[model samples]
Target: MSADTDMEALMDMTRDQLHAAATRYYKKRGPTEPDVALIEYGAARAVFKDYGRAPGWFNRLIAPVLLWREASALAALDDLAGVPRLYRRVDARGLLIEHCPATAWPQARAGDIAYQRLDALVTAMHERGVAHGDLRGGGNILVDDQDRPYLVDFVSRIRRGRPWNLPWNWIFGQLAAADRSALAKLRVRHARHLATADDYERHRPSTGFARFARSVGQRIRRGVRFFGARS
Candidate 1:
């Protein structure tokens, strides 16, 4: 087949098949972990340099598949509230995410505010026919200048109607030990975001909050994949 024909055939492959092919390609290249590289995203995908850090063994073990899968999943839910913006695929290893420079949070304790926004965002996401497979405290949440919390990762958003094999609390309560104020702020933000329990009730299976979440989740997934890919 001609080169164009070969490329066309590859485009028809399933995500799994493409992944397997990419895996084989990388393994032969003597893969290394990311080098703390900050990806400048604006396309669908981008090649990112991974930062070498401690716990190399662990990251190396799961980085390849996890990174790709996480980013792809988040892309699927880019409409969720707090989910980061996405443009187009730049490459297999990099994504063109909406660039939001580092800005201040809405409230005093940025961490706390971020955590609070995360809580609301997650709740809103759940209501909108999706679940964040991982809502851990550390890297999955960010706060905007207005103290608006954004959920950054979504390597694992499943349809609400689908069956989940993990524990709800384990997945949702990843930041249970984070500062109490942050958590509280998140809860308040969610309640406020929904505009009241009545709003939550009205949107119970598809809340409006997911609109923002979709973007936040995308960014989180992108960052995770970028960090985890090199190994």
Candidate 2:
């Protein structure tokens, strides 16, 4: 075999072993566990140039610093003015927002107000061609001292395309009870449907159904875990 081919094969093997090790480590540590390696692992190997300490091994391996840069660029566009501000790093976990204040989960009249704010935020997100992929409840929505609602956690948002709608019904289930019921109905109606980026482009400029379907799908996917067997 050519030297180039041998080098490529060796690199692939190394990546495979590294991924397996990382996966095992992540599984053992759990989703919330923060690993210092995620930040320094790639840098030590010269795979990364000037990424910050927040670039964990998992983030570097999966999302990569360049992808984050691209997302930053797209998010900076004026069209994304409605998208929430990404302030800075928090606890070596993710970005923090100064405007999105934290509030405890609401109840009764407060709950109703919170949902209204949430609906508006979701609508705004759709209008701007973005979908918060993990907008379940509690963590994603923060209430300020004035009871105003703000959005947090932008890691899993779908900024560029439409996807199958059923999964969002599952996500809606994780939010409020009323939303769960609403999403379940939509999921039942469009259970057989599938969508992609093309569908968004084709359906968005003309009909609103495509956008609605995409939102429903994303919510279902995000909330599905709550309705299934406990993890």
Top-TM-score structure, candidate number = 1
RMSD of 1: 12.4
Q: Give TM-scores for every candidate, taking all chains together and pairing residue i with residue i.
A: 0.42, 0.39
Model 2 spans > 4 angstroms off: 1-56, 63-84, 88-96, 104-111, 162-231
Q: Cα miss at 63, model 2 (Å)?
A: 5.3
On residues 1-56, what C-alpha lDDT tens digit does candidate 2 reach at each position? 56556334323433323333231221122222223111112222111111223224
Clashes of each: 52, 19
Deviating ranges (above 4 Å) for candidate 1: 1-64, 102-108, 111-117, 156-231
